[model samples]
Target chain A: MSLTLETNLEDPDAIYEKLIAMLESHEPEKALRASARLVLLLINHIGDRKVIDEAIERAALLTEA
Target chain B: MNVETGKAAWRETIPVWRAFEPSPKPETEFEQARVVIVGTGPVGLAMAIDLGQRGHEVIVLGRFDFVPAGSKAICFSKRSLDILDRLGCGEQAVEKGVSWNIGKVFWKDRSDPVYKFDLLPVKNQKMPGFINIQQYHMEDILLDRLKQLPNVQIRWGHEVTALDTSEESAIMSVDCADGAYRIETEWLIACDGNKSSVRDLMGLDFEGRIFEDNFLIADVKMKEDRPSERWFWFDPPFNPGQSVLLHKQPDDVWRIDFQLGWNIDREACIKPENVNPLVRAMLGDDVEFEEEWYSVYTFQCRRMQHFWHGRVIFAGDSAHLVSPFGARGCNGGFADIDNLGWKLDLVLEGKAPFDILESYDSEAIVTADENILNSTRSTDFLTPKSDISRAFRDAVLDLAEDHPFARALVNSGRLSTAISYPDSSLSTADADVWSGGIAPGSPALDAPLDNGWLLEKLGGRFVLLTTTPFADLPSGLDVLDIAQEPANGLLRERYDLQGGGAYLIRPDQYVAARFRQPTGAAIADALARAMGEQA
Candidate 1:
């Protein structure tokens, strides 16, 4: 699947799914696998530090899962 | 609909309701709605949105005349984000909310140290760490979505002065400042917050002790250079009588709390003139400031022993009011809505019995107790008055400076995540074995769902999650991009989870179980346990 550059990036579900992929990954080459920075950029745009924390945990878990 | 650039999606014009306007006709004249909710805060409004979207008529009684300001719970759990998703407002709420993870727990005489919530194990995809959104803004988003619900009604300034809950339905009497009208509904939910009049009318005992110390919460806008982190400061580590927590709100705003010893005057904190000095003390003297909110109140860990009496149920501050350390108050109310919503549907449609109401009380009481325990423990660690507790807390800070293992222990508890109710009739199976089944009752691991489906499909009903618990993965479940190697064997059997350790998740996104084959009959046993069907 190709990234659509979704504009609704600040949406919590979007951030959750994006971060989930990042969190569930345990295999090597995550950066090559998916773009975590894009997710961060979206969260950064909203300036909600709390949501950012949740997304970060989800991202890490995505990789681990 | 014209999709214009730079305009809010759906061009949803935000309404500034200066004051509430009531209809001339009596409320009883209107059709009896399916659900009538009191209080229009995040909990009530969110429930209205959920029920309305689910095709039920709802009436939301907003108690106050004005939209209350300042910071409420700024941080949200991943489960909350999922609930927001189910309500069709996830896009707007997430768009407006900011992501944050860096948090600091500091001791007095010691500098602040940052801990990242991002470092914790992620539970689901499509959700971020947590969002820092002012509670008022969250209410605004909810109100907007609520307006879109054709079947929903928001009567601001209408207080529910009296209600009669019987097996047949709920009859309510709403009192405006001037007059009152009656509302008959199939069910009534009290989200009226702490000091809830609805809970009071029911004559239910709110059992809990109030802490001797009072807290001062101040919201300020200042041009200060400090790293963005949710910080807890227990100053003068040895006799740390006072504590402070700093939450960064949007637009150069910070929510700061001073946990002054309970003996201080409450007026000394709420007085607007006294706030400036306190702001300068925290952020340094050089920064100019704009003060938005400042108030003082003592903390209490209290909850109604029974969440429901007859047809009415309680939520949020009404059901339980714990210390703010864990952000449990409003979110707990949300969990109530999630549990009650689907159950209400079942009852109205004759799929379940009226006694199912018992689960709400039993389950929510357990949740309130757990929240109180966690908050009290966190508060003790954050603001230790006793010498022993202070010393123990100091040790963690000392360890944070050098030892990695010690730091890990210090940062172990996920304070903001919503808790699980594995003991409820909603959950099935005994404690067997599974990777995610670390405890007897724990939230199910957010297992993979259907394509394009996130964790939300499980909300509004009970969900059973299971992991096969294998180092090697099955080809079918393994094929999905989100699939995982089983966590372990123990989790599979402990929760009676099939394949990977399965978790029985409640509709509001709480865990019911996390194991494999813990019971012979999956749904029946779990439902029986949740509903108190078994002896």
Candidate 2:
């Protein structure tokens, strides 16, 4: 199976709000570290190397834009 | 919900303090004792009771005249209750204490728990998973038990002012209300707490981490009938960005802990005015309650490098300290007493070599290290040091609501459990191939029998538990043949006994060895090794 690129969250806006609230709770340095940790945690939760690699590539491409 | 003003109502209900009266001075300038325990805390009193029950004359010195107030250690684990049962006060403790096995964890602003756990998944055991009773009540129960033992003498207002130790004995100069006197003993055990005077006299210091975070403990009395369970919240709406823990204690007293960050006015924070609002926020404005007791504390996880110091020994908080999150402090101390009691008794009776005391040091260290590691991890999880750590913690909580994997990562506290001494030199290695059961160096698991429980029959002496009977056995070793019992199915299942299986249990109720089929010589050798005898 490939990475689910489409919107899969039950409540995307609520998830976004939670993510934002989490980031706002900490300082910038901590927020960056937290984001890094969150990415790692999400990757581990995914637990598929190919899917994680594809998701990383897609994220990188989006960032480049 | 009605809110009451003023703290007088609840404060009046606090236990009254009894004045200290000094014991009569000894006839001789230097009194000799068989066993002397310094400190009248639960550990000291329990140690005295264990020794006194073994027919050893025990002298316990206490600096205080009365039972100390404050609900210091409210959570007593199952293992601790089992030890209390052996000491003869488990019934009173469980009866007066609120027993619970369920713990619920809540995330931010959520009324429902994201994760729930049952501490005692395997039921039918004699003791519950945990009990919440005031520390003073526990001390009183132990004190009452100690008074019942004629061999024990409790000397209140006796303080150890000076100490000297030789290879064979420890001499302490104690200061009482009258004056100073000296007592010499073959063995001196220190059960003094964190600021241990005995530890100070010995110039021993603990080496571990001191957490910077401070926590406010408020014990309040309310008429509300809450479920008897541990409730922990992370970043709750009432206490934003901080953690909160609530437990149901006996009477109407509820223990509520609020995590206050490193910097704060310690004195001002404990004031009723400052603490009341926080309590009100959690219980709502209408809920009626009165503050019973309040205190702020900072925890440390540390231990002395060695607990056995020649003739002077250390147990409980004097030897080690841990974050209270796991309830390991007093429970670990009980473990120390449980390990040392029987070994010390044997040594005193000339049945075992003095080298056996070294095993107590090594085994108790194992428990201390295990408790410290668990509590330290719990503290770190509760109070993340770095942003990334906090993010990971929050992420785990965020996902915990829906994902089981994330729920496993959340740790409010590990809670306390009995630790097995897998690497002790005393336990004989298993020679048989066993699939599942209690192993050597592990505490014996309890199960119900025909008339009573399993643990009630096993402590204070070496006993051989077997499914098959033997014609002749070694002296001093008693046998409990399960085949003779009417309802022994659960006992057989717990010990994995199909037929002809046997277990050699130590005096402390720990497994010394187990065999599928045993011989007299093998049992004798295992018993000898457990007593620290040379091959």
Candidate 3:
């Protein structure tokens, strides 16, 4: 029932693999909708404002550059 | 049981019930048959007709002299009807049964349907989404069809007392009215239903969880003008805080099920005095009706570890049992016989090795597991095992009334559909770049034609269907040209016939292999692998 934010990136790596597999199985529009819902679920589960802000900032920085 | 004339709609429209005639047997030590099928239920009769049509000598043994009462397993799916169509009884069943394609679900204190689903969205298939008919009517059609096949012999009032099986053959001791006799056969099929004597004699047990809930099913005769659609309610006004299900059958008979808790007395619940109030509450106070039959029952989602045991094979209720919520009981059994009929025929004729029959065992186990999984999930969703589960289910139902996302989470029952055997050893692994078409180990998608549906032509043989013109065919393989004018456009679109693709279809009308580019060598290799040859 606790988040492991200080750990290594193993958990995120596995989640990324599963997300990619899900995207590959669906069509383009369905994959897009599913990605949005996945983000919503993860944010609701985390339920921490500072952690969410930091995660969003890090994702923006990594993907935009 | 005889019904009084001119009193009820069922009495006028329903066919006159007839009992199976007992035939005289020769005073001999033993009789021989190629296949001895125990039990003449829908599964047994269907198997007998399938094997008999293939020129195999079939002997079917039935313990009962007449068809069982009540309308059991009323929902027949499109896949089951297609399988029955190949057996020459599908059209008659559709003609005599009530057809329904739409389902509506209502929650507690709700006037509108919370969720609605259309089972068949298109009208191009050979059969409807599903049909509602009494099991006795379907059995009558199958038994009548069995008479057309001269190779099938059915013996009523003959029960199996004992059985002995080995690697080569099986011998069964049958007790008839006159005396006991022995029947030796190359193969024995145990379709003897849930409490199979064959399975007992073999000391095999089903391994799964038993549910702790009970249900009372009642069939009533009344004149009502409701459409032939499935209606389900969760915590309805009549039965507060419990689930109820309703289905329409032929002759204006309705099948209603009331969910009773585990601790209630089953005997007390089945009494007329207790059941009458529930029936009255379901219908309005003014509606009058007479109860035809009633029963109290419990379900368990269980299956055998394997479908085939040496020379004696098991199918139908003997092989697996599932909750009735999803209509998987008889429908799953039809799938079993469809998978077994061809393989047993091939092995018996020496056209294929006995290892091919093992694929029947494996594939049926996979399909039975799928049915068990779905039925168990539905049962859990309907009758939650814990309080937290119930709260989550109620939340889903509450959200489903307005939000579209929560609608998918609501599960009254997932109606039976044809299962695809994606992991079967008989299927060729897909290597081509096709993304969204019916691939290997998938049921063939049907389309319209000039004279009939596409499946009607492809079934009962090993066919090679190609859109482009093809010259020489491999031995024993039939070619079906998709460019036959009227159906070419839809067939091409549905089957992905672009670039002139070729598909290898099995006798059961399932896609075994598909190639983006047509070739003789590739088709032969895939066909050989499908027949259980080592790669």
Candidate 4:
């Protein structure tokens, strides 16, 4: 299965704001760890290995610029 | 020259320095020129040669009388060589320089490279992937070409003390060795390097990050039988907990760079007594070599908010700077002039509107940003910031030894290449669809033709490359019909002309527009758009 690029979120703006707020609440190191944990949780929730791997690749490519 | 004096020891082996001769006073108190370029570096010289070849009068002002000594900016990228070829000196540079297409990176004390890659995977191009030539040698070649063009005047020992600009022209007060004078010109270009006086006079400054590390560049003359290639090491035994880069140059000179941590004695590190030991450690005691040049540089990736300010423009180091890791410093500068020369020429000739110059500013900034991003990433990879980062880097290296996927993650300075201006306003959006070829706003790819090369035929003017002949084409646009030349399958393959196509290339050899089938109106519209005319 191909990774979905277009947002399927009910409220992308709210979800993005919530994610940013979550990242802002912790110290720099703790924030990194928190994000890692959040990513794992979301990966497990998605559960399809191919889609998750594609998402990971897309995320890595996005960080380039 | 005696070797006893530590300061002048390197000069004995390197190019001789000529004394500065002040230019004679202008016939009139206030001289007028069509174009005035500040700085005599490679970018400025290339700009002069281009304008001179176009039969435009150019005045180049340089603060220095002689070309500076040093093996600075050794790697000239293929795109830069292509630009130099258009200016009439590409072959000389390639002949006098060491050409390399392969780079080997080693991690830890591995006897063999953990990662080996080819810069030019697809060969048979006009120029090599990169040529390692001393900056002074490149400058000399350009200066010789400049002397041949009588329209271009090189004024040595002339420094811009101040600059004043208006909508139509720029006036600068220049102080030469003989005396001071003022120059009024239609266009003024600044190529005076990073610590540019022109940028200061205009109250402009670069905005970006400066890497917190120092690299010691040691150019040495040695007689070694090793093949010419780039060798980079991470945490090598010679310099543990650091990185080292080795590159071969002409005249048996090798450029060896050793990365020193942020906090160190800068002056003490360049001393021969201290530097020789590092060289001995890297190249065993059996090899004999003499020092050619020693420099310790801390690189920064920065550029101005805008490359142009009114009638006065900035190019090369004066406009943007990047870490030397990716060989982007001089190559980026050459790309700047390659973008600007044609635009400025058209503006001076009244052939194009003034707004066309703005495209140069935008397109060049795109190139600068690309160079900065790539060099910054390379710097981050070479010098990991934290413990976790270092661990991650080591893990990637470890995996790279056995896995090709991990090798792809290696970022030992993504060697410089031509940057594509895909978002340029001058480029006409594609109306025709194709599978794969050079898209609009990309530099033309070089290929072998029956005669010379594809790039040689395309440079210095707007050209139309078509597989089928056109009965009515624009007056100024020259056509290069594939059917006229002897068969070269690479041209058709590279341009994806299997189904037949056409491309309108800009003066700098960038694809302005491409079409599956030609229409006179579409070609004219694309040409006008590329010239920044109202479409």
Candidate 5:
């Protein structure tokens, strides 16, 4: 993907899709950690605590880290 | 079907195994399984399992071959478990998911705040307060239970592409990857997910705006030792800053996320090395971790204009998509299965009119609005926008320090416990006040119901109960007794009962209403709403 961190500001959907694809395809641990990233991006784009909270929930599951 | 004997679980207690018996093709379309549900993904599988168990010669379309990833239905409430128990999946579902009683709320570098939700206080909700089993695992359990039934046939690789629920007894035209065929049936129910092809083919309108938040979720192996309780760290949580959340799942796996207060490159955020700093910040300076998987996502809080279009009804994410904060999206679909199961059985068996299908609309809408909409409101408060909203949230979070009630509110939102549908017509009563225990219109509790059974007794149909010292239950409805506490104002206000009161329950287990002693008439009205056209 050509998008940089700055250019990626407008798209939360694409970000989520990419992350979901990763979680669906990768190891359980990383997929779990990525959930926090997912929530952080969402809070920035959507600013919805519910979504961010849900995302953070998935993150905490990655092997007690 | 008979409830199993002696300490038997819900799966064993339900006698669905006898219901899936094969039926001979009859003259009328309804004679056969009028509706054949595909892939019991909370929605489809639930439809097949519930209908099959209920005795509607329903067929399921799915390949039990592929093992699903993580458990999907991670969070199930007391009410949800009761619904599942009625359907025979409760014991197993409850047993499979870990019960969580305590939650930790953190604001980035701020001190940790702890909150406890005592699900035990409620009468009907029992052990395994909340469950977190994978969706696929739960589906497996439900399908196995369906196997015990005789009439339900599960068709694997049954990817239904073109649906023709266009007629009164709609015909579904499905094209599986292997081959294709046209199956003529009475009605069509779509349990498919958000991008539902079934809904698309029908050209129905899914009305609601998609929220702007994009979320990225990753599961990884980490070496940091953390409590099993969920951790919510708000950044500038006390002030104005980004947020981070961390959680633990089965298999030494952890799920973590950053509120990406600003949209950033998905790749950059997920870089193997990039995640180390965040991990160190959240876990400690010296925690070691390995990467597992990563990705990004966005949010949308939308619901269909019509949960039902003619015979093709929608359930699960197809009917509605709630923000995940409350875990409502998946749980809500399970509600659809609970709602449609018995009614479809009655109609398919000619026990009741087909109009009963209409109740799905009212019940689902109210359920979604009360649960999903309320969740969104809570989300806005925590993840506020503009300076004012954030300031307001900070103020609320700050309240947790001194006020127990404020702490309760913060915890309730996290526990996803504020969902109520008192306004639902399905939940009804005459002019009344409220009281202790529960007023007439409430969901069933895990506590005891009359005759040795608890909430499990009223699983299959709408039931009405009396509260006073009496067992004079109306025939054909499940009834329970409620002894009103004289001093409880909430109960008094709810039932309008001067002293004594009773309650009525829907098949899905929400209370219809409470009454003084005369519960029969109020029950009839509640049943009338539930029966709507179905009766």
Candidate 6:
């Protein structure tokens, strides 16, 4: 087995709308849990640690700013 | 298909009610029995038949004269069917029930299924993965089998009002239609349901979480050609924006459950005017249907602190209650049926000490906890009390439509499977190194045999299932040789046997111990431990 990125979401707009609808009413704790699950799911889908680390660095930079 | 639009006809066709015939009154003030079971529902009746067939004087007390109305618990698992088979009603249940294994999960605003899974991923087994037979039919079949046993006595309308437990026995006051009566028994088995009178009389409190979600189940008789599979919708474009569950049942009837939120008039939701529109939306406008039955229920994952209280033992819904998502309500009760009977019989017969009965308490709690955990998870996914949880659930389903990893996260309902007791107190630790065999304390995995299935031969007695022949054996152990008859190398591969091995199987078809080589002394020791003897 090897690490590879899968362009799985053909319709990202619809999925994004669903994600927004999901987080619409969630509090901070719930949002954090949902974010973790979402990140884990994307990480699992990506299956590449290096790619995940780079994305984490980019996210951390935004948070630091 | 003739779809008559009116009241449910299934109620009309329920064959002439076989009311329990009361036995001749004894001259004694209180009738005595080796075991007195309360409630003649599936759990109580199954236990009565098991103990009765084993030559125990068993008496069952039921409050109602007729079987309860409606399709209460419809999903019968493979393990439950095996237990029913031991009680001699497996074949009938299979013949009359709608069998299914595949289940599909669909999300809101999407037509295609997010994922589908097979419940029974193996072949050459005796029973199907699961069957969708109404609970009433199951009770009728079990009651019919109970009648065949001469030693089993069933008294309808004999409601147990109070219970007094003693050091030696327990006495129960029964309120009959005529007057009041009393009965004394060495052991009392309470299968009385969730609102158990026995538990209330004993002042035992049921403790657990009560979910703030309600589900409305509608059994509708309609004419449609759908695959015999479970179809669940997380947020389909139907009645509510929540979840919906649909299953194909026998007699052209289908069970539909709509997840109603906490704030609603439950009494108003089950009305035909309210429910008919929901069914029409799911089935579309063309399908003609008639309402069979309906009920509203909230989920609760709760159980008693101890299933065994002195001489009186609680089983089934009386001991525990689970969210109906997993079909564990009745199926889990069947697990209790498999665990309690032989231990009770042994203790009553003086063959095994009474402390062995405590194993039933520990084991039932383990099973209840397992069921509660799974049901809670499924309920959380299905209902998602917290907003973040709902979003996570939604994200999983949305991603499941494309990503394979996300599909595994989707939990509609695990659907009942046999809960394995890998840490039972009765099992013997593996003394010898072995591979691929069922571990001690696990339910005996089924493999095809030459003439029949493995489980069909391993029921109703303490069995010494060996591939190699033994010379001197423990007293009262039946020997089943799988050596001569191997079906497609399955038996060898499943048991993970190199040359040959021996398995001490309890009467419930659970593996008590396994050994690499056959020694009579070792086998007897395993048997003694399995019967709850101190080392």
Native contacts recovered, each model: 0.00, 0.11, 0.00, 0.00, 0.00, 0.17
Reference-based lDDT, residue B354, model 6: 92
Better of 4 and 5 by lDDT: 4
Mind giving the per-residue lDDT tens digits that candidate 6 earns over B215-294? 89999999899899999998888955689999888889899999989899988998999988988888888889999987
Quality of model 6 by C-alpha lDDT: 0.85
For candidate 2, write residues A1-65 as lDDT tens digits. 89986878899999999999998898887777668557757777798989999987888899978
TM-score of structure candidate 1:
0.72
lDDT of 2 at B71: 58
Inter-residue clash pairs, candidate 6: none
Query: What's the CA error at residue B113 for candidate 5, in Å?
Result: 1.2
Model 4 alpha-carbon drift over 4 Å, by segment:
A1-65, B1-16
Cα TM-score per model = 0.72, 0.89, 0.87, 0.88, 0.72, 0.88
In terms of DockQ, which candidate is stronger, 2 or 4?
2
Show the colliding residue pairs in model 4: none
Q: Tens digits of per-residue lDDT for model 5 on B1-535?
A: 1224322143332222122222222333222347766554666876776777666677665422243453233566655666677778878876666555445676546574634445435433344455655565576677777778888766644556666655466666554433456677676777768878777887875777666655556566776566655666666342237655555655466776566644677678767676666655556666667665655556667888778677777888888877666667777777777777766767667756766666667777777776667667756755676555554455445555665645654622444442455555445545665545454345555453333344555566666545555444556775543453233333334434446656666666666665554555555665666554322
| lDDT of each residue in B99-187, candidate 1, tens digit only | 56556666566664633345236533566656667888888888888878889878866777777777878887776645677888888
Each candidate: chain B TM-score: 0.80, 0.96, 0.96, 0.96, 0.80, 0.95
Could you list the iRMS of every candidate? 16.7, 3.2, 10.8, 7.6, 12.2, 3.3
Q: Model 4 - which docking category? A: incorrect
Question: Which should have the higher DockQ, number 1 or number 6?
Answer: 6
List runs of model 6 lying over 4 Å from the truth.
Answer: A1-37, A42-65, B1-28, B486-488
Best by TM-score: 2
lDDT of 3 by residue, B274-367 (tens): 9989999989888888897787889999999998988889999999999999899999999999999988988888888889988899889888
Chain B, candidate 4: TM?
0.96
Candidate 2 regions off by >4 Å? Answer: A1-65, B1-20
